[model samples]
Target: MQKLPLTLLLATVATTSAQAEGWYGSAKLNSARQNLSSALLTSPRVNERVDAPDNTKTFTPAFAVGYAFMEGWRLEGEYTMPSSSTFKSYWAPFNANVNSLDTHSQRLMLNGYKDIPLNDWLSFYGMAGVGLARIDSDGYQTNETRRFAGNRRHNFAYSVGLGLDAKVSEKVTLGVGYRYVSMGDVETGYNTFANRITARDEQLKGKLKEQNLFLEARVAF
Candidate 1:
């Protein structure tokens, strides 16, 4: 099982500071929650859509690097390395299925927002960004009824985010945001020899919405 490299993860955060121009940077430690829609991925044979536990929590730590083009108007590149969780799916006899694939992701975002000062210590702003999520799935699938199931591969997904930002300090901000992400449809085997097919239709796929509660720290030159 290959995990995220420690050096790469640290470098991602280190870039938040030491930027130039309208160049600004931020770092946030947050709680990331996903709303997985279980109905859309159900098998046609399994008439009853069996419900599964939907809470996969992660210690989401991310960073953003943006530049103010003109006063309040800003544009930047954002990155978040959210740890991978067990991509679990359900089928008849094999209800609890997790093929060891270390499904992890990192997102790059493009943002736009306005910062309005409410008081000397309290400032607020609203922002929106498009997220490009990259995922790597390398797991083991043991199914007696499936053929050629589970492989090591990478998938790219995306999400749209809208949020509010609060300037808590001259160098810090509080953020609350919602992201509607395309989780895509996950396919599982019906039998040990039922040629396994797992495809994520970019268009018309299952959706997973994520809500993030975060705190950001910035350093202004």
Candidate 2:
């Protein structure tokens, strides 16, 4: 009788372990918005500070792959590609000109998640991750007709988010989440003083903060 009970316990443990470990893939649609710091552009000729456009909103796409190592813990890798944003600035000097900037961004992140089960069909999760962002910018000054491109910048990035997941089937889940990302300063395309008679090393740069509202579809293998 004792041997039979021990064998049944082992079987139960094995079954639970098998159910907890698997590979998964996910895709998310993101509505992204940015908050930029002041002093985006500068020139020796004009002492006035130029600020980046505020509350820029864009739609972006995201993807991820992960493995569940335990019942409530997982590790994932994610990527986001955002569309170009247009921003304008002005200098109040005599030869006043409207300057335009086009910016694009992409990020790669590795994250860890802790899942809390609320019921048989519902769960909540929290995740935190670190990433690297690649930012590219190009700009032109209308007055001088001078167009310039900045060197692409690779900056450190990080995000934190909370989400709710609804199990649609044995292998499918749907999720909704909110995420906040911190992106460090990046050099803008106007860094060069090509139109000026004197060359200076000062570069134009700005800090970026982003918020994302994302809807996700995930499948377990």
Candidate 3:
């Protein structure tokens, strides 16, 4: 009976070693940065263009699932809904209360990863992917808040990431990574003055670039 148990244990270990392919699920806690482009506006007194300060950094979370199809390659799909960030224009000539926005985004991506093994328990990986993103915003002007009727746009986005992973158990790994993402320009049209003033009624434009530093936990089966 003792010999039989030892034989089974060795056989199980051999099987696990031979089969390095499995399904994995992961969750990440992300620290994100937001960037915006310059804006140009015209007021009754003058016309001015200004680059506003970057939005506040926010903490967001993301989730993904993947399968290792070969020894060093995996494919994954992920979803993230980042928290809202605010932007306010700071051009001196115009009215101070006329141009503020609240912005947020949701994204879905299909990514491919290549892993390089440093040792039995450590690896480094790089990944690239394409995705769809929707950017939404609300505009606030002088005395009223306006919802831009056609403000939301769906963009084709891309991302790249590099990371280090360490195996902590038979079925678990821990990861730390940095990722960069670019979502194209978003435009919005507004009528906050309710037709009383049509001269300054125009569209708002901005481009988005983001970076994320994250810690992830992944489980494989």
Candidate 4:
């Protein structure tokens, strides 16, 4: 279409071509509690009597940095600090009680985004990126007397997200977003501790995943 360039340019009226090329920082409070599927509670091998479902909720903080180039493309890197969550599971005297675990991750993303004009004061955009995350995790059995596996493992990660913007001025854009993320299999070794008397690492949690909500602000150059 002859008007394609104009159409694209017009869509950014609320944003300004004067946007600069530099590093922008963002901090966000997640909207949803991430789902950490429990391993001990759900593993069928832990004896059917001990077999339940493992589900815990977590809220984590998110941060990111981006470099804008040619007023369009961006190279981004984001990180989510791990959160600790505790829950109880019942099976028997030997393997019944609470379990505590901490999870953390870092992501390197190559992203593509388009800015659209919603009005004189509003703009909308969507971003899609492919990235990998390094996930570190650890878990412990609730019993104070007996020690279960309290080991750590690392994994790969990936994500996708979308957002909308409210232009406060020619240089500032307020935005909100939602994202879906996944972490690859987090492995805890069978017997790699000083004392191999732990009972929590009887099985693996496998691939871990999560969903996050983000609120952001952008200062366009």
User: Candidate 3 residues 67-134, lDDT tens each?
Assistant: 98755788999998766776667555554545666678878889888887665677889999899988
Full candidate order by lDDT, most accurate first? 2, 3, 4, 1
TM-score, predicted candidate 1 vs. hidden true structure: 0.61
Order of candidate numbers by TM-score, starting with the best: 3, 2, 4, 1
lDDT of each: 0.50, 0.75, 0.74, 0.56
| Most accurate candidate by TM-score | 3
Cα lDDT over the full model 1:
0.50
Backbone collision count in every prediction? 11, 0, 0, 6
Error of 1 at 52 (Å): 3.4
lDDT of 2 at 30: 92
lDDT of 4: 0.56
lDDT of 1 by residue, 1-221 (tens): 23568666554433332112356677777677755455233334333323443556777888878776544456767788766655344445445542222345566777676555443334455666765666543334344232223322233454555556555544565666555555443333222333234433111013344566666675443
lDDT of 2 at 175: 92
Please write out the lDDT profile of model 2 over residues 1-221, one tens digit for every residue: 79999887876654453346799999999999876656356566676644445568898999999998767788999998766666666655623666666667889999888887665667888999998988886666674356655658788999999999887887898999999997777665544446556554334456767898999998998
Whichever of 3 and 4 has more lDDT, that candidate is 3
Candidate 4, 1-221: lDDT as tens digits: 88998887776653454234667766666654455554443333345335433445665666777776655456666666655543334445446445444445455555666665566676566677666666555454454443333445444466677777776765676788887777665533332332234333353354566676777776643
Worst 10 residues of 1 by lDDT: 199-208
By summed lDDT, the worst window of 10 consecutive residues in model 4 runs over: 187-196
The positional error of residue 158 in candidate 1, measured at the CA in angstroms, is 5.5
